[model samples]
Target chain A: MAIEKHDKENSGGGRPVAEKGEHIVARHLIEDDNIKEEKNLVIDGVDVSGRWNTFIISRVNSEFDRSFFEEIKKTVAGSRINRCWQCGMCTASCTVTPLYRRFNPRAFIYMMQLGNLKELKKYIDVAWRCVGCYKCSQRCPKQVNPAEMMEALALVIKKYFPEEVKTKLKLDEEVKKIYEDMIIGHGRLDLAKLHTYAIQKSGRTKELLGKIERDAIFKMVKDGRAFSVLRLGKPHNWSSSKEAMENYLRKLNTIENTEAGV
Target chain B: MAIEISNRLGLANVKSDYIHTAGRKLEDIHERLLELEAKGEVKVIHIKEENKPIEAETLLGWKKKIPTNKLWHHKSCGQCGNIPGYPVSLLWFMNQMGLEYVDERNQTSCTAWNYHGSGTSNPVGLAAVAVRNWHRAYELGLFPLFHCATTFGDYKEMRNLLVENKELRDEVRRIMHKIGRELVIPEYIVHYSEWVHVMRFEIAKLKKYDLSSIIATVHPACHTYKMIPEDCIYDKDIYAGKRTAVSTGVMLALGAQVADYSTWYDCCGFGFRHILTEREASRSFVMDRKIRPMVREAHSDVCITQDTGCTTTLDKNQWIGKAMGYTEQVPVMADVMFAALACGADVFKIVQLQWHTTDWRPLCEKIGIDWKKSEEEYNAYLEELKAGGKTVNLYEYPKS
Candidate 1:
């Protein structure tokens, strides 16, 4: 579904360029979206024309590695990965699927179960994009809990493809700061603050004054909800709770980083 | 609660009171269940063949069942903070029904929010917190009923891990021992909605509001239905061989008009961290999928849910939608709040509609409620509360 780019050129007075390898025999055998074919090109003063320079990227997926599936099965979250019969209920009810077609939970679970990490590797850009909505788990007839299964997928990807994740999902520093502050300071989340801060941090402050944004602000203010946020600040007697949470977070971060070894 | 076992089968002669078939305790089956989970067994359990509903009933209590003697009311942070009246309405109703209960500030939040959304706490820390909270309940001779569905699923999953896995339990025990609490899994852990469903008929008789005219829809919280479908109360209509949703059980009891709509089975989209990280996606899910459908398809007047998270999501998102220039706003309230409102509890003290973001004036007009007077009385009561005098509590005395 990611195929989009195309360059067209009329050549030889009547010959069709057939850009994107459409004229290649058994076109389905190659990844059409990824096919590399130049109508006319010169490399090192060589006449790389006609069929000489045309290249069809290999579309054939080989080696269904069950080792990754075994590794995933060992995890508590992905233990039920085998229950997916590819009914697509997970994909159907997925909240993120509607927004991003590549973030398909059913397909991810299938790839994880079959150890098709090569095929899955291509979608690394959208691999960790499950919003963790748990809608898939609810609608799944097999009780697959594809929601946590997504967590398992994320864990496996982080373990196997750390660099890819790092490059693809560039962490927004401002969103990270807002999250850290909200969770640590209050032992709770102020979604409104976090959302506004994230929008501001992303240099979208003008959207903050957009018609929808302004209308939402007025409505919240009119209903006393905006003021309620100040009154309902944080949990009372939260010093010890806060201490426990902070200690736990520190230890967890240490363990994760040590495992990541970055 | 009245479970009939075949007297001829001599189940009574068994060593334990728990029903056993083929000379095996239910815990033995649970142990095997743990093994199946470990083995990654894909075979769905044939309810009639291997372990029937009776087996699950042995682990989770029976239908029409609740502990009337005393209860350990574990307050949900989302409910106490966001809804403000949800937990108190539950306590208020329980006390009215002559059910002795304890609500302690000593008990902390379930700490499940992190595990689901934020990668904050580890498995051991969470197990320790859960056991610590329930151990206090056990000390008080009470069963714990969590208000949040996520907490219910968290407790169930954590308790299973603690009960089945020795290594995790030992780790948790070390933490609990330091906290001066022991790790003994409660016999029965449930969400508060279960108790409400079992007593729906009793609630129907006490309801003072004629709710027949109002259009209502229910969002059965995803965790409550999905986590342990066997544990939740089942209605023939809602289940239909699929997962049984609990809020509909509440609607059936209150004699409210049940609006059939799409997105009824969908999650409230409060993906804990999803909302924090992907606010746009979360908002899209709640508005386009949930709120808009309830408006267009069901013409829903009020959306009732028992999950504190779902309540917060559905109720709060309507306001967010209104701010975004979508005028169709539905008031979302906990099912117990609906029941309590129908039972003639004070709209201010019990329902606390002012704390809600979505305008509920339409619902008020539909229900023939005088919001202006209720608002004034609520303020006066707040003043009285500040002055250290007992204001009129709607259910202060036992409802005789």
Candidate 2:
């Protein structure tokens, strides 16, 4: 274990700067493959006319139209991705990868460079779990925002996947409802009401009610516990004054507007 | 609704009386076991039972075990400046417990508050702050002791960087080396609660006053909960036994009725920048989101928090809520309340019970704490409140 830990520390060893000529040669080889693929497709006369093909073409065109590649280049201007030399220091250092086998920071960058959107979307959930912790970002030999890139990929998934977007929208609405209720209800929380609302939104109200009843019945029938132990009720003064409620609402509005960039 | 039925019965909402009865039966059995133990029906092995106990020298030692020397002191700028007595209280407690530790002025604020709030400040800035503070501890030849969770977290981040990024580690070291310092990660970096709890048995010797009636609630800070789970040592079942993460454990040990409430673990929402830049969202999270529910549902007389930031969010923001029109005043205080209680001080004066809920002056008077003492007496009380010693003038601790 000690030897392995030591090896992990010295894994990348140090920066390995490639010669200018070697980088140029590698770039030409990549470009040559692109040309060869285009030529083969033309000669074969095989029509790649499908939904997947259309999606790929549209994604490529969108990137090309706004020079999205240039934006990415600017974001990682200080990064040493070009000098990466496939060191795998980032993957080794990433905490997320240990939990999520599919999340490979180095592989994601490589795929992004090749414009592989379909493959990127597969790990959208993994990206959303970044938590902006910056452990991976700090450890990156290339100084890449692996977490940010994951977030971007998650965004892309949200954009392209309609069902995911709808689910997210519903969750956001539920969150907003909680915010609104608190603001309008007198700058205080109504726990019972909030729990009820959350349960109803999640479509778990019936199940939750059942669980409560089962526990209460069991306690009464088996151990003869006091009935008072199961009380779940709203406070007497459930609502706040209109002015106080309004102030909270105003604050919520300001928060929403700020978050929305309005 | 079924909840109404449960509420009428004064029980936690559950399916039927069966489970509640079973739970009660289990409690009865547990009580019987305790009874048996008390009567010597159950023989318990013990290393030693003392016929006579030694006298405690300090007020802090009354409730906290003190190590003669080693302490992982986590730093907290907000508490140091705003509630200056909190650290002073700990220092006094340490002295009372005969613990030896070091507090270095050269250490910078964790800066985690700023970084967590604004994405603009990168890990490098946070790591830099951590390295500088750790270097100060190294210079003192003492382990770093962090009072605040953010400080502990920032140091943890620095430790990660040192382990993972050679370049970043080298950069941090170089920066410190230029200032004629070498940053050393402590063998242990801990929250103050953990330190106190670790010494609970010894500290139990100093309890002169009984505090069993004061109903209290622990409001664990989000940063502490999320950043360092291991440091929190509270048991969930026994409200009083719930660990240091919530700051209720010591309260429980002191004989306070620890209330169990939903949203007990919610963030007080004092993301420093959130309060300054996004005041509304911040206040909403605290007043509307966190405190209100706990106050109404928990049946707690006071809510104790560890972080000065959390305390300010819940304490100062209560006035903001009042101005906004929320009438429910729930007093929010710090673990200093526990320290105060342990010192045999009047509960109302020492706990700053007036700060708990708005309009608590009447409550303080009702509780027999003199609310209108002379300025000198008030300052002395506050000094004693912080130092966990006899009351002294406030200006004794030099201003930085």
Candidate 3:
């Protein structure tokens, strides 16, 4: 079968007019992620195959949607979104930005304020990398608290982009369980148990019982310092405090569940 | 707005200038408390009874009264768990100075690690927990001095939040009532480093070794100073009052050459959650961003910090770099641990340097201590302990 070629119009005799998707000049310039092509397509009972039915999403963001801005403003972490004036001070003082340039607080705040969900979605991986170091919040010119603003961004990302978060970021359930049990169960963290469990869960059991750790344990045992951890008992009157905390947490869960219409 | 302010004040267009111009209301918390106390809105647990007071200057030039005695030690879980020497060294220093302090066993972990690392807590719940702990200290008739930077910072934030938000105070009070405790907020939430900063002169008097040959670099814990910038201590003598004075002041007082690095503002990369889940990022960050710079740029002998997480991350993560064939390494320890070492405290029994992954022998040798003899003495002491000898404890509670 012979392929049919579309006739080129003599508009200016310089370059072909990019009317359809196939005539896109300098196609290499477009990012591979943005281009969507189907092998075969049929619309209105007409067959459109290969490059004839290609679709290219525009890279330039055209709309300034404020819906996400309203959504974030309701959060305590993002309440100060209105104070930011696009000053790069927060980004400049950021500890994580120097390492991972994609995790920019100033840029993230601007995206949330303008409701640029499309652009925000692309940074779901690096967005939650803020170390909660208040260097940015300490030096923010407008007192915007870019540190807490990062928290707001994390909440938004988790809510809107659940599938992306599930795939990209590994939420270590074992580590979370250990921390929760320590905090709620005993009201104190057992470092010995945490270190052991974390190392085992990370599949680095060799490091747990390695030469360095073994020597440390031997020294601790010899000095009787290892027993000190056992002697330091629980908080005084912790059971009642535990009960109150658990009750409060249960109440909060119910309130949150009702608000979510669960 | 910032430009207009800069133009009006004839100041350079810098973020610091803007930060100064846009004044924070609760910067002078004591002053705000005076007003709030007058209205009967909040009650402050005053530091009373037998205590020594030393005045330290905060960032805003506000004089903060740091009590030197009759202190209630709030131990850090990480310090107890990972770096046993941190608290032990501080206790040894206190014993040497004959400072009266109580090592309480009833205090709870601040749980800010879980809260910040994971969004598992709300502010109200956190405020309640902090208030409960402060109330415990009040019950003991002593002012609480935090051993963890995270707890110190978290309590300071909780204080501000409880004072500013009436509903938060009510909620916390309700929680407190449920626990059969009263809502008591400390007049000042003090970190142990601040106590060390104020006692540096006294510490110098008891110094047994020459630290003049040693060059030290400081990694100020972000939670200590940066979290509540206004409340942290700063001195004109230390870095012209530009940086926090807790870590550097002690080193300078002990006569060590305090060196500066460019990445002094960078975090130790514990990043709470980053340390747990994305550990490679945390390890790489600590190695590349912090340790390498202190070693190469400053030629420092040791990296001293005040926080447990900072010390642990900076100290333990260095060995991972060696596995990747990066040879540059520096010993990291708390300010009190180094100060305790200079004071001729036991290396293994008291300071517990063996728990640390990085090598501390070279640093000790540079400070004029015979490493081999100290290790032998430590081994003999361990043998004695195993042979039914009494364990050395700096302080013991009086029998009730």
Candidate 4:
């Protein structure tokens, strides 16, 4: 069976519609099937697969997916990901495959081109395992960024998966709060207290409660792990006065309120 | 002074700007050399063949191996404090070789990691580290031996100051007096690698086993390479020799087949501050380019290094790469590979040396290292590492 190239003009041109300081041309050109084949979808002088047109059209049609495909296409066009001719060099050069046979970088790109989001989502967790070593990208024959695509796939997973997104967001919020407290409140580290506060904020209350039953938590309690956490290192005597603290707090509150759109 | 301020703030962007400025200075020096060549003030002689007299005895000469009576050891704070076994391994190696070395607790750390990473580049701090270390060596009646490349480079700067500025010595003395410290000088301050290389014959006596089949590569620490180029004796004929000079030279001399590959001299991505602050950039340099190619393609079993920080980057960061899905695990070790071979340590113990500065028990057990007969101190250290569990703040602490 002969492969049929999907017409991307029906969705939108993958390229930018307007050039800088130039008038926008919204006119759509209709072409015959022969003319469509003659028009090259060459990226970086290499003809891309007809599958990319189908992928682009599918993305443009989804109500919430406006410009999502365009953003990915821009990255692909910029980094030359679509220029890949399915050369197995990247997969062969990849270090992860030898160790983890489940990780197939070439298959990932193939699935991406086919617009297989279900298969892609299944391997979303594997993307984080990429050390950004760039061996695949560096050795890529077509200069496709398998690493960047993996990162992009991870972002898509985080966006679509609500439960996973919530857990990660909570962790991020807790970490940010700790960082804010360190820089704004103390201006230095209090190792012991930081550990206690981190545990408390992370909802390890069950673990804290378990300590009461197990008797394993005695060393931590009696050793003043709770009280002395603030005194693990040299105490910084210098701190903002009450007036300065209030001023700082007001500025912080303003920033938070602005962030919350209040 | 501006550099110092940038460093204290842990501003990597500012640090790189200074590095670029230093690069420009080197370009200026190259321009001067070209200008001198053009002027006819300097005569350049290229002799195709100049016959020089070589003494018959010198060709076959062997120096008497004397047990090193005393050594003034310079400390790497990052390794000595955090990766405790780095100093311990060096001491163990020295003792096994019957070298008398003193670990002077009074000598403050070189502090080069902080100063250099911060972009402060304080000549005073570098000089203090040198003078203090040299004084410790003098008190112990031993030549100063530096384990870290930063300490070696600092001492080299101090040597320059001693020769070029008498007033600097007085300033050093004044600072020492204020700090209530003694100021001792050294006749010779050298890197540990250099000391080991020089005593190759003595080291040969200690090699009880051979690993000539195991292919190895050396990652020469950048501070050692760039700071004092003359002191980097290993990479001189790095590409030309059967084995690259420094890491391969020591390994080859101890009977290991060293593989020659591209990027042998590349930085291990532990550019002190770069590894700590700009982790992605640092890991990119190592995982993307160096370690992955050596392990996966070149098929080298191990990569050896001299500097403590370089060893840590190559070894500990292997896991980071695995977690990140960058590469398969490849064992990274130190020049202590030779020390392990010398002491008749089993392959397990040699592999254990892979984590010379950190906990090696997990690695040792993986490789089947029998800890039962090993020293109690080693076992205790492993236990501490297992229980004391710590997390690194990759964003907060600059890599050293």
Best by lDDT: 3
Please write out the lDDT profile of model 2 over residues B1-400, one tens digit for every residue.
4463234222211122111112222222223333444754332111111211112111111121123244436568777656555666666566566655655566677878777766668766677677677666655555566788677666655555554565775677667668776644443344565555445545556766555555566787766656634323433223323223236546655665566565765678777666665454456567666667666666556767777788777876665453333556666666654555455444433343433434545434433445566335666766877888765442222222
The residue-level lDDT of candidate 4 at A118 comes to: 52
Return the TM-score for chain B, candidate 2: 0.71
Residues B1-400, model 1: lDDT tens digits: 1121122111212233433122243343344444644565311111122110121232233332345446677888778788888877887787767766677667988888888987788889888888888888777656677888988988878766766677887787778778787766654456788777666777788877777777787788878878755455554344332335466767766767766665677888787885565443355467767888777777778988888888887777654443333567789998898888778766787788788988787887788777778889888878888999875655453332
Off by over 4 Å in 2: A1-262, B1-74, B234-246, B323-325, B345-376, B379-400
> Model 1, DockQ value?
0.01
State residue A238's C-alpha deviation in candidate 1, in Å: 92
Distance from true location, Cα of B276 in model 2, Å: 1.4
Looking at model 4 chain A, report the run of 10 residues with the lowest lDDT sum: A51-60
User: How does model 1 fare in lDDT?
Assistant: 0.68
Every model's TM-score: 0.52, 0.46, 0.58, 0.45
Query: In TM-score terms, which candidate is top?
Result: 3
* TM-score, B chain alone, candidates in order: 0.80, 0.71, 0.91, 0.68
Q: How would you encode candidate 2's per-residue C-alpha lDDT over A70-183 as one tens digit per residue? A: 334433231333444446666777777788887777776665565566555555545455455667667766666566655444434554554654564565446545866564
Q: Can you tell me the DockQ of model 3?
A: 0.01
Candidate 1: residue B188 Cα off by (Å): 1.8
- Per-residue lDDT of candidate 3, residues A1-262 (tens digit): 1233333455457764443334344455656666554444443344444444444443667799987787777666788899999989988988898899698889999999998988899899898888888999999988999899987887677677867877775544356568867777788887878888888877788996789999988998899988987776779888898788666655652212122211
True-vs-predicted CA distance for residue A96, candidate 2, Å: 42
Cα misplacement distance, residue A32 of candidate 2 (Å): 57
Error of 2 at B247 (Å): 1.1
